[model samples]
Target chain A: MPVSVKNSQVVYDALKELGVGLISALPETWLVHLIRMADDDPDMILVRLAKEEEGVGVSMGAHLAGVKSAMLMQNHGFLASINGIVSGAQLFRIPLLMLISHRGHMGEADPWQTEGGMLTEHVLEALRIPFDHLDHPDTARHKIGEAQTLAHASDRPTALLLCRDLMWEAA
Target chain B: MRRLEALEAIYPRLSDCVVVTIMGAVAAELQSLGHRPGFFYLQHAMGLASSMGLGIALSRPDVPVVVLDGDGSLLMNLGGLTTMARYRPPNLTHLVFDNESLLSVGGFPTATSTGSDLAGVAAAAGIPYSVRVHELPTLTAEFDAALDADELRSIVAKTEAHYEPPAATSGFVTDLGLLENRFQFQRHLASL
Candidate 1:
């Protein structure tokens, strides 16, 4: 199924407004549209990563280089990256803005994704990383900007969870 | 080749370059040689030095960024090689000292000891330049060439396993912590 063009536009606008210069993305079925949008943006450098943990490291490195960067992945990828998130980014106090597609949000029909969905907020809580849920495209720009501001000010990783309802165009 | 000797050969040549060292012997040895604000000694993050160096290189294209990684560390994050190659930052140089053992922990042999080729892996991953050096002079030449070239390069140097206790008061464990070191490094970069 093709991702909604409108949702991709909103996310891209938000990323641009946050001054994200580089985006490291791991494969996620739901995020294909956003990744494609990032690749098309002239001002942004989109890097395809082999693993989600690599994105955390790349984002940290980008932060040190004085470039604003983001990591795009799904809930499972976020789980795979916990070690890097804790040991590298958190320990170093490097700010990273993460865009995560919330796969298992309430009412999600995919049984395989429910475990990751249920544990997503818990994991972030354990890491003490604050996150916002994006339930509407209209709020994406403001939410993303706020998330980036918080991440930079706190010098810690922050996240925006993109719910399926928000990503899928209204029926 | 000894890791210290490999470091010594290239230490004097490093100027205004950001160096990220993998934790353990490499970090300790680099610290014993000389502590510079430009150097970031990563502790506890076993396989992240190369990735961090890649980040630094991508962000600061004008600054030369070098990663001193170990065989075990490189093996832990082989995916980092492909990621680094994909970006192909001209100012980045990745050097892995293959002692074939986890020297920091008890000397357990790594995959390299049984015959893993990191330079070959880097070349396969699409890095422009990759070489394996067994002699000090060749290692020195490789370092010099990597610094002089505006292309991504990787060097895997065979090193002897030697255990040297790290200083009790090294920069990594000081009260300053990683956060303080990051700020100091950033301030230094800003000055340059």
Candidate 2:
């Protein structure tokens, strides 16, 4: 069974329920659905970043502006953005719930995605940031809510890593 | 040459100016000169001083902002110059100190002077005002003049590619999170 649009919609509904004020997304294959959902929502503030790193900077700046924002970027952007996360986003305690569409993981056809997938855990650890994978419906809603809550309550950023398997299984 | 003169000369005229020195010895030197804590060290982040400075300039256009950029550091985000030009921030000075060598990170050449003229590149990018300096006295005069100018400016100071950098760590905090906060902190920057 191919991952259906419903899965992305399920995640979207959960985020809307969590009160996502702003979302920064790159219109990648898997992320496009969520981007559309976020766009259709009038209350959501969405801004396109020139680069992945700039998105981190914008998120930090917007956080300064007192807006709760999340980043929706391609996994490849993770490479360009890791520095901003470690150097900036994490250090500032600007919490953002990452609605990532996992790329380059085990079944990734592109060679480049493979490298990022292999290093995802190691990279997140290096920054001292905590994250949980969302591949099943049983905990997806709870995990999404908790991540957003943790981002707000603790003032520490949390990541919600979405794997290719989950996207396929549920979508 | 022009950069040191700009630092010394501009401080007297622009009362609301802020400076962000790049990593290595320059940070220690700026610290001794009695500057505020910005994201000054590499551990906090690398090659973001200019970007951070730009954010400040945009937010506080009334106050002057200067980035004490090294040739090597400036090159890493040369594309930023385009954004700088597009934005055209007033009261912002990008003082590029070009020693032609990466003095702090071993004696490797910066390659700043290798292929293109950085000042010219800035001019072409619509910086509105651009100048280069090498001699101390003339550079100082130019610095004073540019600070008083009515438009955005970019200055490239060509110095000895081999001056010994300071060894002490700067008092400046390297926390990007703290610096990006909305509230004003005197500890981070004094009105002086």
Which ranges of candidate 1 are over 4 A from the true structure?
A: B166-176
Model 2's CAPRI class is incorrect
TM-score of chain B of 1: 0.93
Best by TM-score: 1
**Interface RMSD in angstroms for candidate 2:** 5.0
Q: Which candidate should be chosen as best, given lDDT against the real structure? A: 1
- The CAPRI quality class of candidate 1 comes to medium
lDDT of 1 by residue, B1-192 (tens): 889888888998764588888887787777777778888877766788888888888888888899999999989889989999988999999989999999877899998888888889999999999999999999999999999999999999999998565566443343335766788887776666
Stretches off by above 4 angstroms in model 2 are A1-51, A54-71, A87-99, A105-115, A133-157, A162-171, B2-5, B13-15, B37-44, B58-64, B86-91, B123-129, B135-152, B162-192
lDDT of 2 by residue, B1-192 (tens): 533334555555433456655666555455445444332332244555565565555545565666777778777667667656766777777777788777766758867758667888889877888787777776667666666776678888887754433334323332333434323422344332
> How much is the lDDT of residue B172 in candidate 1?
35
lDDT for A126 in candidate 1 is 91
